[model samples]
Target: MDILSLAKSVGSRVEAPLTDLRTVTKVLGNPHMPLLLALSKGFVEPVYRAAFLASAASSGVLHALAVRPCDLESLAERLRIADEDRPRLKEWLDMGIRLGDLTKREGCYKLRSLPAKALAQPGNDAIAAALEEVLRFHVPALLNAPRMLREGRRFSLDDQDGLVIARSTRVVQPLVEEAIARTLDRDAPVRLLEVGCGSGAYVRYAAELNPRLSALAVDLQQDVADSAAANMAEWGLTDRVETRQADLRTLDAQPQFDLVTLHNNIYYFPEAERVDALRRAHDLLAPGGRLLLTTSCKGGNIGLEALNLWFTYADFGGPLPQADELVDQLRQAGFDDVEATRIVPGEQFHAFTGTSKRVAYA
Candidate 1:
């Protein structure tokens, strides 16, 4: 449906305090307003990223401009963009300029301060990579939602070969790390077992935070496990952490860990298996060992709700369970002192905490 028709349909249903049809007329009369609103409501960034990727010299141009402004010819030559590609390159640069990533003056283009800094900083690389992966992989998968739904089938992540999963998980690592730190114990050494530990970000974060903390990071995908191992090694966490490519359900339940974490990966388990997964996590914990679970609950923020829809449509297990339902499951898993707290209230991100019923003697 067209944007105007959609807006009118929505306006008709909303019970606003309006006396007549004039209200809808007044609202939709301003065509630019609706267009601008839609543009601002999450369409802009992906458009910019798509344009950036379409240009062969986009990255090189950004990097070169980070050092110094360059004219079209100089940029083409410096970036090795061929004559045939220069027109497309210029179009991409123009889009970047319009997006405020670059500034153009007197036939030369220069990177804006923030974009320049992002190009120069190593820390921003992960975020950039994540954005690129999302643009390349996730967006395509999302676009296939209608077809998948019609066919009663789901898109699989296997095509991306684990890159999308790894980068996407890493994108939220900081938030998960902060939530874990706030809820988990920090007084003593922690032996953590992180199920579905993508990229080992949380494991490394915890180990770095507590000098005596050690972790066993597990991912079902061998490639992801290998990548996590490399990431741990790069972070100098190899000595304190181990990576295993194994499914959580198949893992030995030895009650060996002081803390077991299931972050953002809970949706991988089918709705029927969720409680069992929680129970298994409980079993893997030492007596009184804490279980920390994090996910966006159903009916949360628009972004999270959209994610839940994609997961459900793609048959990636199931949508995020409701917060209260998750707490009930934790309790049923024989856990004590179960609680659920919002990490970001409106963002729908939350952390669920529970302690195993058995007490530890140290």
Candidate 2:
């Protein structure tokens, strides 16, 4: 039957069964199939594009293309795809060409689209990392949430690739640097304790802002802490900054730091424990020392929501803070003059500054 006859039959629950592939094929060939496909492509293409680009980025395909045009074998070899997988690699690159992120001339592939070129640039590495984060973490957090909930399985910290997160967090470097500038006493000697010091980038930024600043950068994970330490050494801040692998809660209440900062990691602590965590940070600060905490809070876009979703389901962390609630948390943690500012315009990212109100907790 033709499209109309088949549809009318299906609509009437008549002769044709909806499950028949033959009938479906006739309907797919109908006059309106182009419009149907156009609508479908609008939703499907972006997903496919993101997945392809993210893979290309993480697998060094973007770099391979940017460095030089490469034929299938050469590119596959550069990407270290096994000889047996070369055909699949070729197919993938061909799809990229069709997607407009890559082009082929003669027998070689080159970066074609502006985004591919831009992401390949050294300066735009943070943006590329952010794209990887979206594909790697955010998408799965949302798409698999239902199954995860049903299975009672959550994304543990180890489930995430810390290196990806550390790199991706730099996407918010500008906002974070502003918060640092607001809190740091640039000319004065300052001692800093940075919690969850992902790549030690912020610590480097702060050290640059204050010539007399020395810092102890700490992360809960050994690998992350080691990575930060390596970055600090490479940045030539080894003499000024010390990197440690330690959880904030285990640290002694030193009360020596002039500033304590936590950026983009508040949700790593459960809401029940945040006050205590903040209190630990509070105790680490000297009298008059300021705590600079920055985080992506509630009421943000899908990206932030996905982040919150991960933390919510994780065994160790909690939901993104609501602004007033976090303000109260800092207060409960014994911080005086707590103030929060929207550091990123039209976004839920915030910078909070508060002074230590008392000596280390008894």
C-alpha lDDT score of every prediction, in listed order: 0.75, 0.88
Error of 1 at 307 (Å): 0.8
- Superposed on all Cα atoms, the candidates' RMSDs to the truth, in angstroms, are 8.7, 6.0
1-362 per-residue lDDT for model 2 (tens digits): 65444444444553456577776667665778655455445756677788888888878889878888889988777778899999988899889997889999999999999988888787877878888888887888888999999999988888888888998989889999998998899999999999999999999999999999999999999999999999998999999999989999998547799999999999999999999999999989888889999998898988888888888888899999999999999999999999999986788989999999975555
Candidate with the greatest TM-score versus the true structure: 2
Error of 1 at 212 (Å): 1.0
Instruction: State in Å the error of residue 20, model 1.
Output: 42
- Go through the candidates in order and give the clash count of each: 0, 0
> With candidate 2 superimposed using the best TM-score fit, by how many Å does residue 264's alpha carbon deviate from the native?
0.4
TM-score of each: 0.72, 0.88
lDDT of 1 by residue, 232-287 (tens): 88898888898879899999657889999998888877787888888899989888
Which candidate leads the pack in lDDT?
2
